[model samples]
Target: MSRKLSGILNSMHEKNMDALIAVKPENIRYLTGFNPSSFSLLLLKDEPVLFTSKLDIEDASQSSKVPVEELKSLKDIKELLKGKIGIESSMTVETYKKLSNNFKANITDLIEVSRMVKSPDEIKNIKKALEIAEKSFEDVEFSGTENEAAAKLEYNMMVRGSSKPSFETIVASGERSSLPHGTPQVTEIESPVVIDWGAVYNGYASDTTRTIIETDKQEEIFNIVLEANKKAVSAIKPGVKTSEIDKAARDVIEEYGYGEGYIHSTGHGVGLEIHEMPSLSQKDNTTLEKGMIVTIEPGIYLEGEFGVRVEDMVQITNRGNVLNKLSHKLTF
Candidate 1:
């Protein structure tokens, strides 16, 4: 077995876990190197194995580093469990109940915790994904409706070799931009448009957000958001709490009396999945560590008016290093 796989098995043994049941697609891909299209499971132990449907068998066989087996049903999985099993906390309650009847199941985030720190190879994939996303944005013509702009940008990413968009492309314009998670609509482009987009490359993901401002008020909010993003990035370092990084950015907006407008967490870890552990939010206490890549996005939303957000991918080394190369200021 590879040293990394053996290390994970050793860790599981230390925790008194006979097996780790990974249901999250990202976790499955992280351990096995196979991306599943339908439901799949990974049982991690001394001899790690992957269970996938018939449709994914060919892909899994070609990509998976470990042994791959055809999955018939949950009943088949239940029979495979021998002793105490570790399950991810993100597993749905319904699935948990269904799977917990026979085995000693305990909720664990062992895989996610390990994923917080990126390997050198993982970082390279993330950088490539970011490069594709940034280049695609530069090629897009921002002179159309929100939906058209989003569609064009996504097409560019795909043509440039991204398997797909990391998430539903956000292209909120004008007042709609104020909604932090606003989805693209058929509305015409306006004074300010918040474009939050990402792309998937070789199973890794990159997330970034940029706002194009065309009004004085929009510029004001943009500056505040930018300042917050900068402060947050500056605060990232080994051993610092994730919440502290969040406050470093949030305090800036709050000091400007726009605290209430900042509705979401400052950022989150990105890897095989766009969103992962070590969340930079008030509720998360994960400590910063080397080789971790996360986003530093802060925003200010004015109700029924407009909003601005500046986001960039940050690599936590001995200090924070911004991975985005594009200039923050963009105007139309």
Candidate 2:
């Protein structure tokens, strides 16, 4: 059995869980190398088994590290499950009902917890993903409409071996930049373009944001955001609370009197999923650990005016190690 599977089994045993029914796609892929195209379930126990749909069974068998079986129905597998069964929190209520009968079902994050601290291979994949994203950004021409620019960026990433964009590419400019999660529009591109983008490589993901500044006010705001990003990145290290890193950035923005404008958390983990565990926010108290990769993104949005944001990926080790090769100060 793989070390990851062994660790999860040990954790389940410690929790008095007899078996774990993993339905989340990422969890299944993490445990077994198979990325299911359709719904799949991994029953984790002494000898783990992957139950995949008929459509994916052949592929799953070829890719999965564990034994693969065709899933006929929930009834067929329900009989196999016994004792205290562990289910993912993301399991739908309907699905839970289908399997919880005659057994004690408890929501568990055993797989996700294991995924938090990346292995060396995982880190390498993330770095490659970041490289693809940054290189794509460098090749993009920020002319034409905002949507066109976004399309060009995405195309660049795909051609550069990215399976796909990690998330929707944001190319908001001018007043639209004031919207933190703004979508690229068809209107002509404007100054102070706020581009937030990422790319995926071999299932791992990378996230970054760079705002192209034009005027003095934009530069002023950009510098403040950059400072906040630096402070946040500097605070990343093993044993530090995620919230403290958030404060490190929040303080800089608040001191600059953009507290209200600085919406959203400091950052989040980046891996197979764009957003993962240990969110850099006030409410989350997760302590940073070595081998964890996170993003340090700070922004200030002025209503009806503009916004500035600087984002970079950071790896937590003895200290913070930034993984992005792209320059923080990007220009057209």
Candidate 3:
């Protein structure tokens, strides 16, 4: 086993736990290095093992660092448990109930906590994914309807080596941009378009959002968003709380009278998945640490009018280091 895997196993043993059952696909990948398409399970202990469906048997056998077994039924898994069992908090309540029948079960975030800090190889993969995503954006023609722009952007990312778009490409244009999570539509592009997109490379993900502004009002909002993003990036340092980072960006937006318009959290940790731990939100108290990769995205949505968002990936070192080199300002 790798040192990281050994560390996680040692931690489990320290807690007087026999084994940890991980169901989340990202968690499974973190420990085993295999990305499962269907249902999968990871039992972490001294001799870790993975249970995957038949569909993934070939892929799991090839990519998984741990031993793989065909998952037959819950009854079979129940037989594998020996002592006190641990489960991820993100596990569904139904699964928890089913798995807790015979063994003493406790909820734990062992895998997620470990994933907060990225390894050197993981960081390199994320950086490469970001490069592909940024390059793909430059090739997208933003003059057409929102859906057309999104389709073109996704195609560009695919052709440039992305396995897929990290998420549904957000191509909100005109007044629709005011909705923070607005979906692309058939309507023609307008003065301001909020393009939030990402790319996946070798299963690692990158997330970024940039707004193109056409008029002074749009530029005004864009400037405020940029200011928030800058402050948030500057605020990242070891020991700083994730919520504090959110406030740093929020404060900038509020100072310019767009606080209410800034709806979502500052950002989130990104790795094998688009959304991960150490959420940069008011409710999250995760402390910043070295080797943590996160996004510093800030936005202002002037409901029913227009919106602007600026985002960039930042890998937390001794200090915050922006991973993306693309210019924030984009005009057409």
Q: 233, model 2: CA deviation in Å?
A: 0.9
Clashes of 3: 0
What are the root-mean-square deviations of the candidates from the true structure over C-alphas? 1.3, 0.9, 1.2
Q: Write the per-residue lDDT of candidate 2 for residues 62-159, one digit (tens) a residue.
A: 99999999899999888998899899989999989888887989888788888999999999999999999999999988989999999999999999
lDDT score at residue 58, model 2, on the 0-100 scale: 85
The candidate 2 region of ten consecutive residues with least summed lDDT is 323-332
Per-residue lDDT over 99-167 for candidate 1, one digit per residue giving the tens place of the 0 to 100 score: 777887888988888888999999999999999999999998787788999999999999999999999
lDDT of 1: 0.91
Two-way TM-score contest, 2 vs 3, winner: 2
Best by TM-score: 2
The TM-scores, one per candidate, come to: 0.97, 0.98, 0.97
Best-to-worst ranking by TM-score = 2, 3, 1
Q: Which scores better on lDDT, 1 or 2?
A: 2
